[model samples]
Target chain A: MPAICFIFLPIKYYYVRTHDEGVAVNKLNKFPKMLTRMRDGFLLNIGFAVLSIAIFLVIWYGLSIFLDTAYLPTPVEVWDALVDSFNTPDPSLGVTMWDSIMASLKRFVIGFVLALAIAVPIGLIMGFSKFAGMIGKPIVEVFRPIPPIAWVPFLFVVTGMIWGPILAIFIGVLFPVLSNVIFGVKSVEPQLIDAARTQGASKSDLFAKVVFPYTIPYMMTGIRIGLGIGWMCIVAAEMIGARGGGVGIYILTQANIGRYDYMFAGMVVIAALGLLTVEAASYVERRVSKWMGA
Target chain B: MNRSVLITIIVAVLLIGAGGAYVLLSSDDDGENKTYDVRVGYLAGDLHQVARVVASDDDVNGGESLFKENGLNISTPFAAGYANGGSVMDAFAADDIDIGFLGSPPAILKSLNLKIDIIIVAMVNSEGSSVVVKDGIDNFTDLKGKTIATPGVSSIQHLFLLELAAANGMNVKLDGTDGDDDTVFYVQVAPKDMQAAMDTNQVQAAIAWEPYGSQMILSGAGELLLWSGDVWPDHPCCVIAVSRSFAETNPDTVEMFLKAFIQANEMIDGAFDAGSGETYDRIITLATEFSGTNETVVLSSMEHMDLDYQIGDNFETYLEDYTQSYIDLGLIPGSKLADRDYANVTEYVEDLVQVQYLEAVD
Candidate 1:
């Protein structure tokens, strides 16, 4: 069977097997209608995305012609440059475009995953305990406003070039994820927790069952925002200094050498990576939401 | 949409359209006899003292007044600064400034890339830079697998480092990463922070221009591994460059500017020749004032540098060698050499060096 049909078959079998005789007929009929609505929605979204991208390209092409400078390369030139970079290692930088992208992605993922791992647990504790909240709140507020670029020099001194950029990204993503996760935990309905406690649930059970599921959506929201911040931080951090070739370093080296087309190509790759990762995060969010029926 | 909102949007669009049109139209005002603000950039190093002396309007010690005396109405100068030559060219590429006092490597690289149409007008100074390493690291061979910092990848000091490494048969890598254990690593640290990086043991050594290198030695943070002059005697370091458009439009003004620069160079030479009097004191004072460095550092750095006032035969040789070094380092395309042999590279280097203004000055 086709994949789409296979997906629907399980739903049909489960409802048909579980529902009462009268409800079974109604549910079986409703499933196809719901599936049709979902397919249409997916198509409509794809259509809008394509239309928006086409408009953006048209505007970019118009501007490039109007500017008429080497600095402002046309879309076609940038595309050619992108293709050329992917195919060949730029002799000046000693790395291909794919290598640069992979290097940047590695740093971004490591830093972001590390930030999420540390921030979520601290946020949970801060939300659950008043003493923890009081102690952590001031530190976060004080450090959060300082820009990530400012930390480059200090981090370079402490971590060296290889790990400095990674740590800088981690610092950039930490606060937003932490604060939002705290907000997620605090916003959990108190009545739900009280009810769980009344049902003979222990503290750990109440947290696992009641608090955790309620906070997952908010935690996802934090991760989404943190991912964006981490991307921005990695670029700036790499520009300050990098040992291996990264997208940011590649763009900067190209700019310094007056290869504006390749610079733009690097920028496009970074944007694409950012979009791809955010889409992946959204996919995970949707799967979890479905599991929780949220 | 509502009628009021529609009208407001139309007005905003018209305003933005008009503003952009004005910018586009006004850019053409750089015609004959049209005076525009002159933005001059200089590195924050002692090598740029000649340009600094010329740009300043301080009556007691300013080069702007001297230019004014020669009937060149140089509008009050706009000063742009960078820590090193690499960033100076970056500013030029961005159109942040029209003229720069920067090192030869960056100037050559910028012209090769055609980012800015620039002509080297005059030589600044030479032999002022050095390679300094932490104490107990006695020689270039000791730097294997150790980290060293320079102003930037394309700065002349970086070229000097690479040339030295190549001479010693040492493998050098520009990226500051964990590479082969036998390779040396180089990172870009701004000149101002080179001392700090050395002091904090962030880098075991640094190749930098004065007075940062001098500061490091004075503070006991490092010892001189090699003088730049020891590698290439009287090698060209910083040169004054002007955008080709600026030179074309304001030929007479540029000539006058070069005349003033030559005069300042002469004055510096005369002071150093006197070797210990009011004249030397004045040069040191002016250098300290412009460089924002202490008097002792400036004095010590001056001892190491020879300020060349003229564009000489050696400049062509230096330019060719530097360009070849760039090609060898893979910072520029080797195809620049594919069509040409050594003589052609010399001719190409000569094409970039416009000496008419400097020659016309005398």
Candidate 2:
């Protein structure tokens, strides 16, 4: 049975991929070069994501069926569970998959934004001034190694249950933004700085026109990385002790109570979030980079 | 402009990185710290009372100070909190906690592996769990091959569910632990998420203890399948434990804590004035503060739960049974703890449990 499922999925994915390819080929012959290029690039990116997902599911589903263990759910089971969770209203609490997703996204955005606001200025300073970087870099490095989960109790007690998740997510998101901004600032060429300086530009003018424009590309890169870290940190931050309302809280709660479908559903929401967030961030990054001509 | 600028930048980055590393590293290791403070870790559930008392209440502290004039300094290492018992054990190994409460399975597994000098201060609860099945499901036979959720793999619920599997003729195996081929399916989820999971139909069944089990039953997500406490009568679920070295050094503090915990348990168990406004107020506050449920719900739910401090035959027998289950689950090697005197943890527990303080205060 496991073997049959294994054989079935790849064949299905292969057919999907080929059908996409055939469509792409048909369009390519008629469309202009630039339009065709854009179409293929978009199709290829979507294809990679789907193919990866399909292959992973095939392997996971097959192994679970083979092992026959309760510990590991097959891909089909997880998918089915995901659907079941969305369709059923939780009997105990009114929390649905949508609720968990929204709660998590809200937390992620707040933390990520706070981190961005703080990390960018400090990183820009570190990049421009040798002295500031020297003083700040060591502090950033020390905190980076500590896992965000480690701080759950501290933030919970200090801030109480209300703001603990935000505090944790802030820590999780802070470091990446700082590091990336520093790299971005440093990457701007000396020639650009020299040209601006030669033009009698003031300190602010030089930074605003020369350094800032060049570094936006790097800033976007940092945002992308920071957002990913912040997203993953949702689980730890939402450890809300007993007042759990976030997706991580939702997942753990569901899992404990043997609500496999809801657990899977929560996981799917998180996964979709990661994918959606990364894509959105990436799109903004491309547009910004293009505008900056970096 | 030449060598000094480059050197300064390099030194600054290195210095900041080193400082960050120091903060992370020092937070983990406490074995060498000479400060004679009792760092206690507890699962956040019932310990809110203790936390409130520790931070504010004068009588509890004053009564406790009779044993030792030195007031204890308390610092919570929030990172290694009471969620997963493993986190507490990690802190213990690092010398962060003097006393802590952990679920039974993890406590047993750690005891077997580390040979760490720790003793069971007392068992927290000595009752089996209630198996919660989704609404409309009836009896254990209806659960054959159904997906279920238990706590962490080494938890008491984990062991009992496996025992349930074995009794029902399905061989459930722990991940990376056994070669057994049980057709039963179960996923391990934390207790807090069970309600949300049920609401979403993520699992068909779950095994929960006390307040949570009661919560599920009340919420209508599940109906009670044989309550384990009813089935096995006093199966141990949680244990309060202390680091041996820490306990020896901070004997007075240990006794004070034990007294307070026992008092809290008794207060929870003793029949209150059925009509006094204070009776319901405290229960509601605790339920809201700890469990996030309204007072009316917790006040009603408290009727079914037996929250007491008595150490009885059930604690001893369940310890043996649970420890064996840990061994069978391959969470702990049988050889590691085959010789420990389970029947007489009393000798170890006596020095740590200051019954005198509780007796004096009561």
TM-score of each: 0.81, 0.48
Docking class of predicted structure 1: acceptable
- Give the best candidate by lDDT: 1
Winning model by DockQ: 1
- Residue-level lDDT of model 2, residues A122-231, one tens digit each, is 98999888999999889888998898778876676566434667778888778877888888889888888888899899999988888878788888887888777777
For each candidate in turn, the interface RMSD (Å) is 2.9, 14.6
- Alpha carbon lDDT at A53, candidate 1: 73
Q: Whole-model Cα lDDT per candidate?
A: 0.77, 0.63
lDDT of 1: 0.77
Please state the CAPRI-style docking class of candidate 2: incorrect
RMSD in order of candidates = 9.1, 18.2
